[model samples]
Target chain A: MPEPLFLLSPGRSFSSVVSTMIGEHPQCYGLPELKIFSADTIGASWEKESRPGSWPMQGLKRTVAELQFGEQTDKTVDAAEAWIRERFDWSGRQMMDWFQEQVGDRILLDKSPANTENGANLGRIVKAFPRANFLLLLRHPRPRGKSQYSTISKVLDKNGIGGMGFEPDVEWKWTGTNIMARQLGQDLALGQFMHIKGEDLLREMDLYLPQICQWLGIRDDAEAIEAMRHPERSPYATLGPVKAQHGNNGKFLKGPALDFERLATMPEASRDGPLDWDETAEFTPQTRRLAHAFGYR
Target chain B: MTLVETRPAPAALATLPGPDKPVALVRFGDALYVGTAAPDPMGRGRIWRMPWPAGGAAEIVYEGADGSAVTDFAVFESQGTPVLYAATAALGGGLLLASRDGRGFGPVAPAGLGQSGNLWLGPLAIAGGRLVVAAGSAAPLDPEASGARLLASPDPESAVWTALAEPGFGDAENSAIAALLATGAGLVAATANPLRGFQLWQMDPGGGWTRRLTDGAARFSMNPAATALSAGEGELLIGTGAPARPEAEDAAGPAAPEVIALDDGGAWETLVGEPRFSPEGFKVPFALQAAGFGQRETACVTAILTGPGGALTVVVTAVTGATPGPFGQPGLGASRLWRSLDGGESFAEVPAPGPVLAALATPEGGVLAVAGDAGAALHLHALA
Candidate 1:
C-alpha cells in the first residue's frame, strides 16, 4: 500500500484547504477530516467523540461514501456508516488499508485537525502507520490565534461546549500541536516530515507546491502541479449528503475555490503585538519562540 | 599545466582494512597518507599510504593502540628533508609524532604537550618557520584545562612548546581552534565558540594577535566554528559550520555552512553562502553553487585541500538519510566532496565514492578521499 500523507496541525492553520489542494494532485486522494486516529479502534472513535449536532463522523462517512461507493448521498452514506459499524473493531491501520485499496495507486491524505490534539493522538497515528509522511503545517501564531478564537469562541459561547466557564484560549492548542508534531517529526527521517508556513504556501503556491511534490517523491511536472491548483475539484471539497453534511470546515465547503485575492491581501501579523480578535491577548514566550522558528517575525 | 576534460564522478582506488572512519589525509612524496580511526573516538588509529597513479594497495605505516586516533597531518621541511607530522588524540592526551620516512614514526612532543586535558590535537600548520598545533579536549578529560590552546615549537626534536596566547585565545567560550592557515598576510586561526560564533584571529610577523573576524564573520551563532581554511592567491578562504553537533540541529537551527574569503586588504567576500545581508556588508555567494553546495542539511565543510595547478577540493559532512531513531538521532549519511578546477571560481559535484570523511589533494593534481564506516576505501579523483 502507498504510504499516506498526514497534515498534522491544529485548527485554523489552513490545513483543510491545503490538504485539499495537495490531495487534488493527480497521484493523490485527499480525504475529509477522518478523525479515526483518536481511538485505537473505529468503534471507540465513533462512541467516544459522540455529541449532539456534532457529527464528527461525517468526514469518515462522506469519505467512505465517495471512495467506496463512488458517490456521497443519503443511501451511500448510510451504507458507508453500516460498513464502518460492522468493522467496529477495525484499527486505524485497517481503515487506512481499506481506503488505500479504494484509492488504488494514488496516495491517500488525511488532514484531521483533531489528530494533533495531543501527543497521545499523534503517538497512536505513528504507532499504527510507521512509514506515513507527515506534513507539519504551520501558521503564524498571530493569525492562527485570531482565526481560532473568532471561529471557536462563538461556537463555544452559543453551544456551551465545555458546559461551564470554558475559556477560549487557543494558545495551548496552537503551540501544543506544533510542538507535538515537531517532536514526532524529529524521530522520523530528514525528509519524512516537512514544515511549510501556510502563509508562504498560500502566497507562492507555484514556488512551493512543486517543491512539496518533489519531497514526496511524486511527479512535479506542470500537469501534476496544475492539477493541484484546483483543490475545488476534490470530491469532498463541497458539502456532502445531509446525513454526512460536514466532513470539513463549513466555510471551505461553501467556497472551495482558492481565493487568491484574499490570500494575497491577508494582513501581516507581528510576533509581539496585540491580537486583533482578542483585546488583551498576548502570545506567550513559548508561542513567540515557535513563531520565530517558523520564520514569523 | 594540462587542460583536463571534465569528468562526471570520482573513481575508487582501494578499500582498506577495518577501522573505517578516515579523519585526516595528507600528501607525502608522491603518495597519499590517510589516517583512519574506528567509528568510536577512542578506537585505534592507523596511518595508510597509497602510491600515486593509485593502483597499488594501501599499506599501513603506523598503528596506535586502542583509545587513540590521528586527528591531523602536516608536512614540514626539516634540515633540507621533508618530515610528516601527525597529531593523535589518545587516552593519555594529544601526541605529536614525526616520521622522516612513511614507514617509521616517533613522538616529537610529549603527550598533550604536558597538559593532560589537551586530549585532542589538530589543525597542524607550519607558520613563521615553526610548527603550530591547536590542542584541546573533545571530551571532558579535565574540565579545568579543557579550552583550546595554540602550541608552537621552533624545533620538533627539542619539543620546547610555547603558548601562542592564553587557552581559547583568552575566551573560555572559544572551545577549540577549529582551523589554522598560514596566509600571505599572517598566521590565521579560527576558533569554535558555542556561546557566540566562530572568531577569526591573525598573528602578524611582529607577533601581534588581532581579532580579524568575529561572530563567524557576521553569520553569528549559526556558524559555531570555522572548520576548514585554505590559502588562496592573496586571499584566505575559511569554511564555517557547527560540525561538532549535527544531531542538535533541532535545538540549534540548521547551520548555514559558508566558505568565506578574506583578502590581504582586510576585505571579506562570501564564496559559497547564498546572498544575504550581514553586519559586515551585503554578502553574496561568489560561486555558482548554492549554500552548503545546495545541501541544506550539510553540517560543515571538513576539508579544503588545494593541489597543484590551482585545483581545490571541498569535503563536507552531510546528513544523507533520515533522522530515524526515537531520540531524534541523525540517520546514516555520507560526507560530500566538490571539486573546483578554476581556483574558487566555481565548483562541480563529484559523486563521492562513499561518505567522504577526509580528502587530500595530490601533487599530480588528483584528489584522494577516504570513505566508509565498517571498512574504509580510498577514492581518487583524477583530472582525465
Candidate 2:
C-alpha cells in the first residue's frame, strides 16, 4: 500500500498553504487535520474533540466545512460540521475511508500541525497507519513562535476568550514538538520521512513544490504544478463564514496581516505581553547553535 | 544562476539497521563509528561499531549496565591512548563507562562525583585532554543540590571524575546542561532552564565556573534544547535552540539563539539571528560536530525543522565552527555546506543534498561525509 502523507509541524507554519498545494495535485487528496486517531475509540466525545474550537477539531472542521459547505456563512459552517459529525461518527478510519471514496484510489494527505505537539498522538498515528509518510514542514522558530503569540492575542481579543495566560509557553511547545518529530524521524528511517522548509516553499515555490511532488510519488507534470496555483479550487478550502473566502482557487484566503509589531510590544502584564518581541529580545547561544546547524548562520 | 544536477549513485547506499534509532557518527583512525541505541531487552543499549568502507554490517562493541540503553558516547585522546566514554542509564539511574580498546567498558566513577538516583546524561564532547558531559537529573532533585553538573576527567585512563562547575542561576531541575564547548577562554557549557531560560557558563581549572551569559529570558523557550560548541579563528562558537521561540518583532528580528561565539574573556555575541537562523514552524536541534579547516575550523549541527506545511526536514548547517562573527553575524547559507573565509563574519553557500542528518570532516582535504534519509552520501567541496 502507498504510504499516507502526514505533515508534522506546529500551527501557523504554512501548513494550510502547503497541504492545500499538495492536495491540489491530481493524485493527492488533502484532508483537514481530522485528529481523530488521537482518541482510543470513536464516540461522542471523539466527535466533540473534532470540533472547531479544539486544536484537533479545528483542522477537521475547517476541512469538512471547506469541502462540503464551500463558504464560511453560519448556515454552511454549521451544516458542514454537522455533516462531518454524522458521517464519520468520530471514527478517524471512517473519515479516512470517506476521503478515499471522494478522491478514489489515491494517497490521502492528512495534515494537522497541532498533532505534532503530542508525541503520543504521533505514536498513535504511526501505529494506526504504519505506512504513513511524514513531511515535516519547518519555519524559522523565532518568527513562527512570535506569530503564534500574536495570533493568539488577536483570537483572544476577538472571541473574548479572556486574557491570554502565560502565552501558553510557546517556546517550550515549539521545542517539544520539534524534538518529538526528530526522535520519531530517527526511529522511522529516512525514506519514510522528508523535511521541507516553509521559507523555501514560499520563496521558491516552483522548485520545492516539484520536489515535494516527486517525493510523494505524484506526477511532476506542468499540469500538477498548475493545479497548485489555484488551491481554492480544492474541495477543502472554506471552513466557516469567517473562513469562507479564505481559501479559494488554490490561493491563501485569509484576512490581511495584522500589525504584529504593536501586539509584540505590549507590556508584560498585558494579555499580549509575552508576545512582545522587544521584551524577549536576547538570543540564547542554544538558539544560535540551532540556527547555525540549519545553515541559517 | 545555473542549476546543477548530480547523478544518483550507481548502487543504493547501505540502509540503517532495522528499528532505526538515532546514531552518533564519530571518526577514529581510519574508520567512522556508527553508534546506535540497541533494543536490548535488559534496557542497556549497545554500540555497534562498523568498519568504514567494508560496510559489511554492524558489530556490537560496548554494552552498558545490564542492557540499559547507552544514552550518549564521546571519544577523546587520553595522553596518547584513545578512550571512548559512554553514558549508560537504566532503571537505577545513570553511570559513566569508559572503553580503552573498544571492547569491555567498566564504570569509571571519579571522586566528588555525587551519586544521585536521578542523574541522566544527554550528549558527550571531548576537547584538549578534558572530557565534558552534560549531566541532568532524570527526575527532580534538590534545589540546593546540583542536578546538572559538569564532570571532567583530567586524564582519560584515570577513573577520577571531578565536578568542574555548576550553573549559577537555577537548579538543574529547571535547567539541564544542553551542550559544552571547549573554547580559547575555557570550557563553556550551555544550560537551558525552562524557568530561567538559556544561559552560558564558563568553567576554569582553578577559579571554577562563572556565568558568562544569562539573557535566556530575552529569547523564547528552550525545549529539547541541544547545543554544539566549536572553535573558529579566535573565538568559541556555541549553537542551541529548542523547537520554537519568540522571534524579533521586526522583519530582521534577532536570530533564533542558534549560534553564539565566546571570546577569551568569556564574553559572548550573537552570531546569527531570526529568519536567517531560526527554522520555520518547529525545529529542535540534536547533534553537533566540528572539523578542522586547515588552520581554521567548521562545525555541523543537525536539527529537525517543522513547518506549517506539515513536514519535518532534517537540517544541517555548516558554520565558521570556531570564531564569533563581526556584528553578531556568524555565517550564511541554507544549503548543506557553508564556508566562512573571513573568520565567521560572512558565509557562502556550497550546494549539497537535502535533509542532512549528520556531517563529519573527511581525513582527506575539502571533503565532507554526510548521512541522511536519502542514503549515506558523501560530498567533496573546495574549502576556498
Best by DockQ: 1
DockQ of 2: 0.02
True contacts kept of each: 0.00, 0.00
- Listed in order, each prediction's TM-score against the native is 0.55, 0.42
Runs in model 1 deviating more than 4 A are: A1-297, B1-13, B53-55, B79-81, B139-146, B244-251, B307-311, B319-332, B341-345
For model 2 the interface RMSD, in Å, equals 12.7
Error of 1 at A1 (Å): 46
- Candidate 1 at B82: error in angstroms? 3.1
Candidate 1 on B46-159: residue-level lDDT in tens? 888877554577788988876777878999887778999998877787789999987788787788888877877877999899889989876211112256899998787687
lDDT measured at residue A64 in model 2 versus the true structure, 0 to 100: 63
Lowest summed-lDDT stretch of 10 residues in model 1 chain B? B323-332
Instruction: Give, for candidate 2 chain B, the lowest lDDT window spanning 10 residues.
Output: B288-297
DockQ of each: 0.03, 0.02
Question: Clashes in each model (backbone N, CA, C under 3 Å)?
Answer: 2, 77
TM-score of 2: 0.42
Displacement of the residue B230 alpha carbon in candidate 2, Å: 1.4
